[model samples]
Target chain A: MKPAPFQYLAPRSIEETVELLREHGEDAKVLAGGQSLVPMLNFRLARPAVLIDVNSVTGLDGIEVEDGTLSVGATTRQRTLERRLSAGGSGAQDGGWALLGEAAGHIGHLHIRTRGTVGGSLAHADPAAELPAAVSALGATLVARSRDGEREIAPHEFFQGFFTTALRPDELLTRVRVPSWPEGTRSCLLEVSRRRGDFAQVAVAAVVAMADGRVVRAGVALAGVGASTVEAPDVAAGLVGEVPRPQLIAELADDLCARLDPPSDTHGSAGYRRALAGHLLQRALLDATSPTGAAAAA
Target chain B: MDVQQESVVDPAAAGPAAGVQEVTIRVTVNGAVHERPVPVRTSLVDFLREDLGLTGSHVGCEHGVCGACTVLLDAEPVRGCLLFAVQADGHEVTTVEALATGDELHPLQQAFWEHHGLQCGFCTPGILLTAYDLLRERHGVSEAEIREALSGNLCRCTGYQGIVRSIQAADESWER
Candidate 1:
């Protein structure tokens, strides 16, 4: 497997990466973990003129919690974050910690996870992928910087379309900041894939807050169903101003299905995807709202 | 001007190939540092196997599906097949060869042998380093988590059951 010839530069710091990026301009691609970019190179799918290796950059692989927000550096590898989050070392706030940790545990395999960076995945912007959906569902902020300045993009606005992001040339994602887990809120992610490690045909992430045993706030995001994450505002509205019951989640599922027109992909038939979307959405919502947290959770 | 942070490229030396001009890169692999001039396009897998004489990190599929080329990049497991040698310059990279202190097998390696974690052993190095990275974190990973963690690696021999078991046992008992 041969790739197109390209110049390589190993930059030692983010400032260097930014400078080198300015030097190379649109011809260069930032080498994060290379889990995705390398494959694209081998397949001859990507042919960048220069590669700015950002691995040597210090302070870009850190995960820190500051002032009610969790900030994850763009270069932080997935396995490292999974390990840190699972170990509760990210100092996650209430509802966000457990679910983010749970979601991290479900990403690809050890080797892929070890080398794959969340920023890379976010930058690559695969619509059917998990991290993008998780970030969207959790409403994380995407931060990108270039030689000129930095820009902040919300999850809903970050994704431009399938395989496309709002990031401009010469800009690199620097970090993702997510809201602290709110009180009385529980969340869960349910994904259905034909095989392990394959892209999800349909995946759902749900967050529900209960006040005195009554549903107060809800957020729902689905991946692998559309060009970007399909946020079910109606489904979330269904839960809110109502109570947490099996019937309500089921109703939300039906309403969400009606709202989202899932596209047909190789993984599954369009009809099959729609059906699974409803089913998975219902199940994910129920799991999030579960009092025991073990009932029907896999 | 933001896109021209570095000193302006002289107009006399501008071309498509100029953007990708080859350069020398020095890499520290396993224990030794290698200083050599290679084309900018060569991957790290080729450099380790061909230049440095470290072949333990296997290259399976070459498309990043098989984990045969897994190695530790700055103590983190990564597919060697995917990175360019230029990227590893100045980093402490530990391949499968560096797992043992002397002749003593890394506990994860020992567990794989006793548990029959491998059948043909073609995918062992990839699996070994992957598990090595996973076990580094505390807080008890679950069985389902173990399966998800290794999903990037495809074992053609179908020895995943024992493979998972080996990683599970190693996570509980292995030490640095």
Candidate 2:
């Protein structure tokens, strides 16, 4: 169970950290909260010659709303984000950022949330991870930095494939910027995992806004059915300027079910994921459109 | 600009060579500061058990699946196995050993005993610390919340009925 030999370096500043990343390049792996990395290290699945510990890097743990975007620093722990979105936390209001709390609660166990970072989960890019789908549904932009400079990549472009990302070996994911919901916009997340806190078999995030009883905007994204969180543009387009009734949601969900072509795995079959995606999206939409504080049916 | 300028880079600066690297870390565990040089791969659980002789935090499923190696890092529950000793540098760690005071067992330990929360006691330490952190952090935690909080710690014995009862009893018996 012991991890292979590696050198650990703790850089005190972001510049020094970037320098370390540029120096080591692909040979070094950045360590955030270590919730996912250390487990892989112990299993000998990840063997980086040098580990650049970013936990000590300054100015990488802030959470704030800047210019209508909820900017989350790279090292912000998942538990911190969860609490901030909970009943009394900062995200309780203003753009429905509290929806992150719902998705964060479904991530692993409480201990894992305490140690897992938002950037770590997104960078890991697990198909079943709930955070990625939630962020994607929010249409968030990921910020990556290297020796050259910084570049902002959208979630759709950032996530390349299974456990693969557009992040270069010399780049460090520095932050994520999620555009806050407009006034009266509501959002919710739903996932059907095998166990209570396990990775989602099919996860969905729904953000919807209505003006004069007609849908003004909608964003729907699904996870666990593809390499990255699958955003339904057609569904979003069909939903605009229409009434979001039960029948309309059902039609959109049916279209989504037909569009997904998930692979079969030990956890579930391709058909099962396709069916699960439809149901999860339906439930998420219902929850988002329902009155606040009224519990959505399971 | 000053902060950026202050970041001096020395390309010739030494880093880990090949695979082996030794680093010194200072961790305050159970109210005592210990400084030691350990391999980069040494997990906090191993460092505590082997070097510091604090075996109260047990190691199970070293890949962080099982919560047997859970400990309070800076007052938050985290799996010690998932963290290298180097990560704990300049941090505070609370283990199961800190739960009792000399001859007197803490209220949580007493509640576990009175409620029969353990049979083999292998998972007790991790459960105890996990419950302790929950009780301290959150006030008036309900049964459902208790179950959710302790969900990470897996207790094969007692089927978690007694463990849940113990935590509830501890909550009621404590002043909080």
Candidate 3:
């Protein structure tokens, strides 16, 4: 279970870190929280020649809001994000970012979240991870940096497939920018995991905006039902300009299930995951449309 | 941060070397400071057990699934196996050994003993540290909250009923 031998470098600044990344290219791996990477390293699944520990790097671990847009530093601990959202009077709940906290709580236990970085989770791109689907449902933008410069990639582009991303070897994911949801927006993230804190068997993220009892805008995304965080744009579009009803939600969930070709593993069969995805999506949509907008786990 | 900057290898010089590379790290474990050279690949739990001689933190499922390697890094509970020893440089680590003062057991430890929280005792140390962090963060934690917080730590014996009671009893008696 020991990790392969490798040289360790802790850079003090983003520029130096990116420089190191540029120099080592594919040979180096950035060590953020090490919640995911170290496990892979210990299993000998990943054997990078150089490990760039980024915990020492400054300016990469804070949550900021400007002009109604939420900008979360890439290395911000998931626990920190959860605390901020759960802490009343932070305006996080009022700012339409509370769904992030809901999803963050579903991550591995408190011990894991204390060390897991948001950027690491997003970049890791696990098909069943909560943060990626949550961010995808929020229409977040990911910022990647290299020695050359910084570039922004939308969530759809950021998550390519299971454990794969659009990030280049030399690029370090630096920040995630979540645009403010339209006023009166309600959101929820619900999942069905075998056990609490375990990876979700199937999870759903839903954001809906209503005007005069009719849906004006909606964003829906699912995880563990596809190779990547699957955005159901067509399903979301179907909700637009329509009144959110139980029948409508049931039909949309059926459409989503039909569209999903989920992978089957020891945790569950493909059919089970597909059914779970549909059920969770329906529950998520109903919860989002609820007056309290509180999420309940399946 | 009075870190030894000179000991840090220059990023430019760090290449694709297959040989073992040891880095000097100054970490405070259980309120005692120690400086040691650890291999870059050595996990924090290994460093604690081997170098510091604090064997309370057990290593089961080194892949971060089992909470047997839980420890406090900077006063927060984290998987010791998930962190590299080198990453503990200039950080404070609290292990299970630090919970008690001399002959007297910590409140959690005492509660566990009184509640029969262990049978095999393999997963007790990690659970203690994890519970310590939880109690430190908040007072008057309910049963549901305690169960939720401890979902990560898997206890094979006692069926977690005694463990939950121990935490609840400790929470009532825990002092800031």
TM-scores for every predicted model: 0.86, 0.95, 0.95
Write candidate 1's Cα lDDT for A1-298 as tens digits: 3787666667777777887777787899888988788888899899888777777678788888889788899888786777677524555446755555556556666667777787998888777777877777677899988889888999888887887888877787899998875587777888898887767888888877777777787777888889877777778777776777888788778877877778886788878888999988888887777876664465
Candidate with top lDDT is 3
* Docking band of candidate 2: acceptable
Off by over 4 Å in 1: A13-16, A19-24, A87-90, B1-21, B99-120, B131-150, B161-176
Better by lDDT, candidate 2 or 1: 2
Fnat for the candidates in order: 0.53, 0.53, 0.70
Model 1 lDDT per residue over B1-176, tens place: 12212222334556544533455677777778878866667778888888888888888888777778988888877778887776776687888888877989988899898888998888888878777777777547788777766776778785589998888888777865
Model 3 C-alpha RMSD to native? 2.8
Give one digit per residue, the lDDT tens place, for model 2 in B45-137: 999999999999999899777799999999999999999888898999999999888999999999999999999998899999889988985
Q: The CA-based lDDT of model 2 is what?
A: 0.84
Tens digit per residue, CA lDDT, model 3, A138-210: 8889999998999999999999998999999999999999888877888888888998898999989888888
Q: Give the TM-score of candidate 2.
A: 0.95
Shift in Å, residue B133, candidate 2: 1.1
Q: How big is the positional error of residue A198 in model 1, measured in Å on the Cα after superposition?
A: 2.1
Question: Lowest-scoring 10 consecutive residues by lDDT in candidate 2 chain A?
Answer: A289-298
Best of the two (1, 3) by TM-score: 3
Q: Supply the global lDDT for candidate 3.
A: 0.87
Interface RMSD of 3: 3.6
